[model samples]
Target: MPETPPMTPPMTPPMTPPWTPFALFGALAVLAWGAAALDAALAGGRWPGIVTGPLRGAARELVRQRRRTVMPDVPLVRAGVCALPAAAVLAAVVLPLGERPVADLSVGVVWFNAMEVCVWWALWLTGWGVNSLHPLIGGYRFVAQGLAYELPHMFALITAALGAGSLRVSEIAAAQRGLWFAVWMPVAFAVYLVSAVAMAFWGPMDRPVGSDIAGGVRAELSGPDRLVFEAGRYLLLAVAAAAAVPLFLGGGVGPALPPWLWTALKTVAVLAVLVWARHRLPGVRMDRFTRVSWLVLIPVSLLQLLVVGVVVL
Candidate 1:
């Protein structure tokens, strides 16, 4: 038939690979580590010069002013500022070292939670050390925000610990040999993700560093001090993503890959999500976050704990 058109080929949809959080973490870790190393090398060991140089100059100018300033006591502020980098180093060493079961401790869950608390305290100290009104306000805001997120986040971890019958992160990963906790406890995982973002001051929870209002607590920091704080932030992001993988997503459960590689993939995925979210959301007002945390996250976390108890029991 001259009029008959050739049969159109059926269009096939493009095959999309499943997206994983671990992949994002691995990529970000490499990027962050590389950048930090490069910055350290090029800047003559002044790694955080990228962020802190201006702040340091400003602080020096302020010191020369001879004018009175209303701020927290200087010594207290210095101590707090000093602690942030120390905490980051501790996390880098403690969280990712050793294989499963070898590094797994019965009290691992408690230790992880305690470290987060320490992070909160150190951030407050940094804010307080600025000894200026904006930093003080920013620091207090951080405290309030911490109150909103920390309890629910702790509860979510507890649920996982109870479900696996051990606080050890490696053991929790082992328990998910057949299935991931993400499949069974999606709600808890969701809550944990939200809390982690909030704790890290990313995305919708970044009011403490709100450029519009307080200009953030680190506004006055510079040189090595500033670099240390920024590095700590990146490391904190890395640690949180790493923890999420082992705790919730059946750490490194996969075919055709070693456990460590699998873990790396999962952590990378989580970090990417954090970075993506940081780019996507407008920060919530401080008051709005406080309300949401108290009214929504806390109750949900408690309910999740109850659900885990029933399932595990």
Candidate 2:
């Protein structure tokens, strides 16, 4: 009788709820518009500018002509400009909306990093393809910047994954049910924020499109091409800001509000802080920033990672 015990059923993986692609893109569009409006308002020092500025600028760009450059690699420039937003969207796939991601990849943390690397490619191609000196310099600057920030950025990501002992973003978010990672892992959180800005080439990291270099990488862009590139930039920033929620801010874990609403609120808060930083922080030279990144940030992040590992053990 004991030997005839009924066989247990096979274990099935938990099912994830379905989410639509349109929802993902729609959220991104709204965030991008918000970022643009906020930046415009700050620049003008008038709160009223936030209402109509983004719409006015977008309409103008849509109808403007694509300004020609001498011996420009048109195809390459086109690819680069379009790829920026495409990369942003792809990266957002692994990021959970409320509690479910469009694609809940096992290695979501790694996936986000890989997609962000595409920004470097986009910048380089756009800079080089334009066949201009300042743009070329801007492209090279980003490469140097990448080398500087990417190491600490990766370590910060690894720390988050290590703390949860999972690469899946949702799992990581779940692990923080007790305490938000940003609260415990302050160093990693700070580094992540800094790298987020640098990756998007926003705020203090806008040397890639600095006014001194005549708009740098985007100097030659105009019309629809310019529109696409600018949209892509804002989109990248929005995605970066949103990813922080799952990574460090305890995604969708607030009280009272629905999970999705909590996610939206957190995202807006982060995006506002990032946009405000542009008006406050001074632009830094890539060389000096690189030195600080390697000498200071890298070591600090490594220490933070070590502390997290010990605590986990």
Candidate 3:
């Protein structure tokens, strides 16, 4: 009894340091950059040639010369169109995970907004550069569509940031440790999701890529140029989903698995949903979409922000 010693509590394993995300992000950045650059350089100027070259000899023998269709505006549109997706891939590289790197940056929300705005610029340039009527119309339509959705989207985002009392995305994610913003601000989440689909021109919101009329903005592109746009769409969807994970679904918050894996899985799942919707939903008319965006989506998003403010206080 005299020799009996007090027993100590069992030790718990140490949580992985948040700094590990930096290394993971760096690797992702390098891979994305290399792929994007290679895609741009090879496909921008010679896309049609790249696509039809092998078939040309066979086509010459089987078809009349009059059947040959000259591919249009490969150089200009290709160069401009390649830049945004390239930048998006680059942004994905630098975006912080698990934690914010520079906590004191005052304009963190501004940074995210700026990046999102670039998506429209990149898309517009691609359409305009094509020097084709269909794409130009598509580009113009994109601008109009953007006007309809961007304000509401920004309001929702700003409300969340303001309510959380931080511009930092990491901080916003952290604030939802006890309860996610989606739970409290369900309307904002819904508005954000709808706007995100519209902004990316995906699925039912895919008026810009209308297969029925004008064949959408990317109708004229071929070869690697077409590939770039196609790939860019996927990347945009992936990035949007990734951004939303932290904002709504509780980023990397799970029982098992590391944080980074959880983030990747969530992003992939969102992309899958977009893909499914792309096949399932019919595209809406541009006029109808615009009206819905302004009349319905905007007011709802604004109200959601007000709700968030009340809950936060």
Give the TM-scores of the predictions, in the order they appear: 0.76, 0.94, 0.73
Candidate 3 residue lDDT tens string, 44-81: 53655544443453344344322112454555676656
Please give the CA lDDT of all the candidate structures.
0.68, 0.91, 0.65
Q: How does model 2 score by TM-score? A: 0.94
lDDT of candidate 2 over 1-313, digit per residue (tens) = 6978887643432455544567899999999999998898888746666767777788999999988889999889988999999999999998888888888888899999999999999999999999999999988888888878999999999999999999999899888889999999999999999988999999999999898899999999999888899999999999999999999999999899988898899999999999999999999898888989999999999999999999999
lDDT of 2: 0.91
**RMSD for each of the candidates:** 16.5, 4.0, 12.0
- Native-to-model Cα distance after best TM-score fit, residue 16 in candidate 3, in Å: 14
lDDT of 1 by residue, 159-181 (tens): 88888998767678778888888
Estimate the TM-score for candidate 1.
0.76
Which residue pairs collide, candidate 2? none
Candidate 2 Cα RMSD (Å) = 4.0
Instruction: Report the Cα lDDT for residue 247, model 3.
Output: 72
lDDT of 3 at 70: 45
Tell how far residue 49 is off in model 1, in angstroms.
16
Which ranges in model 2 have alpha carbons more than 4 Å from their true place? 1-19, 45-48
